[model samples]
Target: MSRPALPELSLLMVDDAVKAALLEDFGRAGDITSQATIPTDAKATGVIAARQAGVLAGIDLALSAFRQVDPSLDVSVLAQDGDKLEPGTIVARIYGPARSLLTAERVALNFLSHLSGVASATNAFQRKITHTNATVVCTRKTTPGLRSFEKYAVRCGGGMNHRFGLDDAILIKDNHIAVAGGVIPAIKSARAFAGHLVRIEVEVDTLEQLKDALTAKPDVVMLDNMGPELLKQAVKINKGQAVLEASGNVTLSTIQAIAEAGVDIISTGWITHSAPVLDLGLDIEIG
Candidate 1:
């Protein structure tokens, strides 16, 4: 089946990241093994193949790595991001100088496999709550340098993105409430400091806090660690006042119940932080 159209990520957007990864792999010595063993003129064809079932992502970024290593390398993308693949799927074809292909293989696979893993994991959560109104959203818990790429992968897997960073939105967590004396004070402080355009979301751990947050009239209220029963009551109390988000201790076994409790968004960190890397291999055919 054809893949759905996803937003185009320009090479410029990922160039720095790809370059940093290549630099880390190459160091100052370069691919010494390839230089010593392979003939400089040798050419080869290679395939990026999946070893297991997954949702494909980061094909372009992977290609960028090869291009950065050798601009003359030819890469033909067979599958775009967001496409579901069975085991042994060929994602892309590469033909290039054997030395360049060998040098870029690991760095390319690192980006492709890790982002595909995030996409696949996010897809699993998205599939679970297909019947519900709750949207699966990713949290700020992501690889330090790859948040944008990881969030893009989440979108590819049909998951929504929460705040990109603390600067973009105001989320009053438990610590903020504690420091400010209460939820209302925290929300008020945020409102006073933030511009009218900034959105204020307060996180509450109990019904009492929820009531206080409701009184503050923040843009959104996150129901932290609330079970299904409390979430239902919170939903009813909210009465369409603010967007309700359910978070904390969320897992595949419990997401459905949380979603059924009528929250607008369900946020989880595992999709970005703990997703296992997808198994993708690059096999080269020497010519």
Candidate 2:
């Protein structure tokens, strides 16, 4: 499948918000060392280089962080979002005041590293699954304020994104199941309450519940915590009736096995929430 396109203006706007947050993080004072050691009039050039192999993302946000510190800074992108990078690869080049560069360094690195980590994790999961028609997907397991950027990184890493927010889709989870007393009732209430355009997905923990959910004709069915062998059986039972999404306790080691079971989508929380930060750094080029 082709990569999804993100609007340029939306990306820029998100970058602006991230920049504001970074400014709040620093307040009036800047990096004390750069402020003390670097001349106020000092001009410097540098590169934000990756220290390890990983997928690159949040290039725009990093650039915006630097620009917020100093708009006149000349920023050039050597790698775009979704680009896979090797160690020592220069992802971006910046020429500006030494102080602005130093001040923006942490915020920029923070976003870059986190986003790269998400993308890296996502790519590894996507690599699993050989024959079955299953797409790797991400859940709401994202950084609180950075959902858009993190989901964008998921897309960059070749994984599909679930609903960006609760408003975007209706997922009747276990709590909904309890409130309604069963999967069928929950799905029924969701269908009755949801707008005409809204689609309802229901989560089922067992084949019996899956059957009930299928009978109710949900838009999607989430097979919660089902292992690969069981998932294959569920897929057989589904037989294209509704989109099948396998979720819970997913890991890189198990993803390929799960995907081969023929689930339509696999949602893993670890990609965004548990991935370690990809190491990156910005080193000043002395002139």
Candidate 3:
């Protein structure tokens, strides 16, 4: 099956992150083993290939690691982000000074494998609910410094990102509701404080709370942990007045039912926070 290409994330988006990672790995002396074992002028070729099947993401991040580690290294990408991968798929190629290549190896693989995992997980989860119009979305539960990269991976895997951060939108969760005394007040306060451009989404755990929250006319309402049956009722009660987001208990096994219940958005944290890393390896050929 042909899959459409996703927008490319420019290398600049992840430049600093890549540099930081490489710097952290380099430490004070930088690749001491490589420095000792390999001569500075020694040349080597490398092929980064997938050892397991998965989707591709974070090509730019991987490139950033290589380019930042040694600007003189020659690097080229064989597969772009969002592309499907199989065991033995060639992701990229690098030819450069042996020491530089060895120095950059782990950092490059780390970014590619982790982000690909996020994309792969999201793809699998979204496929479970393809029959329904429910959109697969990622929550804020992301690695602290890697939120943007992980969210970008979510998009690559055919899922949507909820909100980048608290500044982008107002999401009133259970704690906020409790602190404000009720859902309505929490949403109302969020609405009043936010400007005309900001969107407000309130979280509710029960039908009565859903009803009360609707009265405030927030942009979206999150149905927290409601089973399929309650979700169906919430859909009927909502009547398309607001975007209904079904969160909690979202897994590959439960996603289909959640989508069938008629919610517009199915948001989960597992895709980003708990995704396993895709296995990739750097095979070096010494000259």
Candidates in order have lDDT scores of 0.93, 0.86, 0.91
lDDT of 1 by residue, 1-287 (tens): 55456767767879999999999999999999999999999999999999999898898789889999999999999998998988989999999799999899999999999999999999999899989999999999999989999999998898989999989999999998889998898999999999989999999999999988999899999999999999999999999999999999899999999999999999999999999999999998544
By TM-score, how accurate is candidate 2? 0.94
Best by lDDT: 1
Q: Write the per-residue lDDT of candidate 3 for residues 1-287, one digit (tens) a residue.
A: 67655666656668988888988998898898998898888999999999999999988888888888889999988998888899999999999888888888999899999999999999999889889999999999999999999999999999998999988998998998888999888887887799999999999999999999999999999999999999999999999999999999998889999999999999999999999999989998544
Worst 10 residues of 1 by lDDT: 1-10
| Candidate 1 residue-wise lDDT at 199 | 97
**Best-performing candidate as measured by TM-score:** 1
Model 3, global lDDT: 0.91
Question: Which ranges of candidate 1 are over 4 A from the true structure?
Answer: 1-5
lDDT of 2 by residue, 157-218 (tens): 87888998899889999988998899988888888899989989999999999999998999
Clashes of each: 0, 0, 0
Clashing pairs in 3: none
TM-score of each: 0.96, 0.94, 0.95
Error of 3 at 142 (Å): 0.9
Alpha-carbon error at 230 in model 2, in Å?
0.9
